[model samples]
Target: DEPGLRVKLAEGPQKFYIGVDPTGPSLHIGHLVPIYASAHLQKAGHQPIILMGGGTARIGDPSGKTELRQMISYAQIDKNIASQKPQISKLIDFDNTNALLANNADWLAPLNYIDFLRDIGRHFSVNRMLTFEAYKQRLEKGLSFIEFNYQLLQSYDFLELYRREGCILQIGGDDQWGNIVAGMELIRRVESAETYGLTFPLVTRSDGKKMGKTEKGALFLDSSLTSVYDFYQYWRNVPDADVERFFLTFTFLSVEECRALGAAEGSDINKSKERLAYEVTALLHGEKEAVKAREGAKAAFSGGGDKSGIPSEKIGKAELEAGINILDLFSRTSLCSSKSEARRLVLQGGARVNDVKIEDAEALIGMADAVDGELMLKAGKKRFFRIELTD
Candidate 1:
């Protein structure tokens, strides 16, 4: 398939697509693989059709899930797609003549059930579908009928694209291998066209943890979900072994440049990490935000750099004068989601106020803790939040 696909790609501009389901309000770093791959292809002069899975998301993709996906309302799905559009546009140029934004809902939502069942459903085999890893795993945990229909809908999406856009290629995460192949088969069976599918390997850290995962959960592209500072820090703090591979895979940097940067040792490696962090953050959040994030990280670590980039909030001076409980303070910020979590963080010595460890959960944060009308809170070694004392 690779050889044939390469031959086709070498011929000229080919329309290729990658689908993203708006399951969440924000796209996490885990979702970047296919998006980056699409970017590379687009750069190579291939036309990109970014398919928003507004329709298929309703049924929920069962791939890589052990349980049924929580179905979201159509309104929420629309909102999710709108929210993710800008983030995706940072990589793939939707404004370009060669690029297209498509919604499967445009077609999938209006199809008659009986017509679809009789026409498209006839091609799928229950035995063959069950053999796929996605369903096989879900069957043990109880796969829903709706989820079982996801593959068919996804396969039909390919056929639809083939007919409508002349898209001959589908690309996605390796987990989507079965679905991609099914889509290719569907195109062949229905349109009798030779289409292709490409799946990228699952990205993981050298420590065996999934890439883009952080203590707070998945590293989101949305600054509101995961602060730009934290997003930059995730790459900065990546395992030394992953620096090279990440640069090669995530960034649009030349392969030669990525290797040279990855080959750095000792203190120089930190610079490589910083560069990788900056490039990635800049790609997603713009250079200004990336620079701010980098500066924020430096201030957090070096004790004397610009702190404006750190995730921050302002509080009334009277509040600090009256004093706030350590747990309450940390919980109010992004550091801890709740009081109990804040208590654990404090008790575990992961909470700090202006560089001083706060071991007691009941410890008070008062005006005295404020330095030059600012209080810096540290959660663990990496996360930092700043509080400005306002009059």
Candidate 2:
């Protein structure tokens, strides 16, 4: 059962609030749990407020950490906030009658230190605070005063939202339950308001590893950081054990529908994963982009056919005329890890140029290989690139 939070959510003109710290410039798969839940609440006819933790981000939350995160400069924080707006806008309709976007710095930046300590800080207890999981863990690892005060500032943000926006519910991941409960308690003590806190399960891979990360680094929502084709493939290649959960946690598909997809696992799991990838990619990057990304993946993984789906990169005519080695080209485009790896791939019959296998490691590719002025290169079973020769 999803608990009665959704039921209770239906009983009144209630406003729901969820906070996301601008610790990074983009949201990843890790953020989808809360974002999808908030979007669900909105679809169910409740108001949803997304609080951008511009102020608290400066202080840095120490939850699930042994050391304080490096403080981001004010300029950097501002830039991050600006970058996140478009990505968030794609998920929920902010123009809807019941949605809001707020920045905590609006209030936190102007507060008097004495007043904050005398009023807001009065409701918090050191004895109770130290018992929190985040604080207790940090204490063992040497917690700082600035990190210690994080919960207080976060709790104050909740209370302020309740007062100003009439918000009554706060949503976050399970790791944030301690901080969330503190916020609910603060609202009860200071404003005498009955606010609710709901924590969703954190998403993890079947291998018990966290999602949204690869050997390279975090999978950013920004296309510049991760190409749409790569993003689609990330979801498509999800372990069968984790695919259904990804659909449920990341998509608007109902539980019953998700279950139906899960039940077909052994025989048709690939289809389900494809649907998951397409739907999720469409939500983030739009249907057209998702379609193109899917096509690009097929072309890259399916071997040389029509070169239309290959991702293109521009090169100089002089370079092509001079005849570039296939191994060097693969390495330069990041299609493979190193020149040695590229040569190894060619030697193993895993490398191809313009749909033809390259057996010679030192074979120089020239303009003759360029069809319609572009040369398509294939590395192994899942990588494709197009080089455009330009004068």
Cα lDDT tens digits for candidate 1, 1-391 = 8899999999999999999989899999999999999999999999999999999988899899888888799999999999999999999987736799999999999999999999999998999999999989999989988888999999999999999999999999999999999999888888888999999888988899988888889999999999999999999999899899999998999999999999999999999999999999999999999999999888989976679999999999999899999988998998899999999998898998889999997788999998989999999888899999889
Q: Each candidate: what lDDT?
A: 0.93, 0.83
lDDT for 274 (candidate 1): 99
Best by lDDT: 1
Candidate 1 total steric clashes: 0
Q: Candidate 2: global Cα-lDDT?
A: 0.83
> Which parts of model 2 are misplaced by more than 4 Å?
1-7, 265-267, 303-310, 323-384
Q: Candidate 2 — worst ten consecutive residues by lDDT sum?
A: 302-311
RMSD of 2: 3.4
lDDT of 2 at 196: 86
The CA-based lDDT of model 1 is what? 0.93
Model 1: which ten-residue window has the lowest total lDDT? Answer: 89-98
lDDT of 2 at 23: 81
Provide the lDDT at 258 for model 1: 99
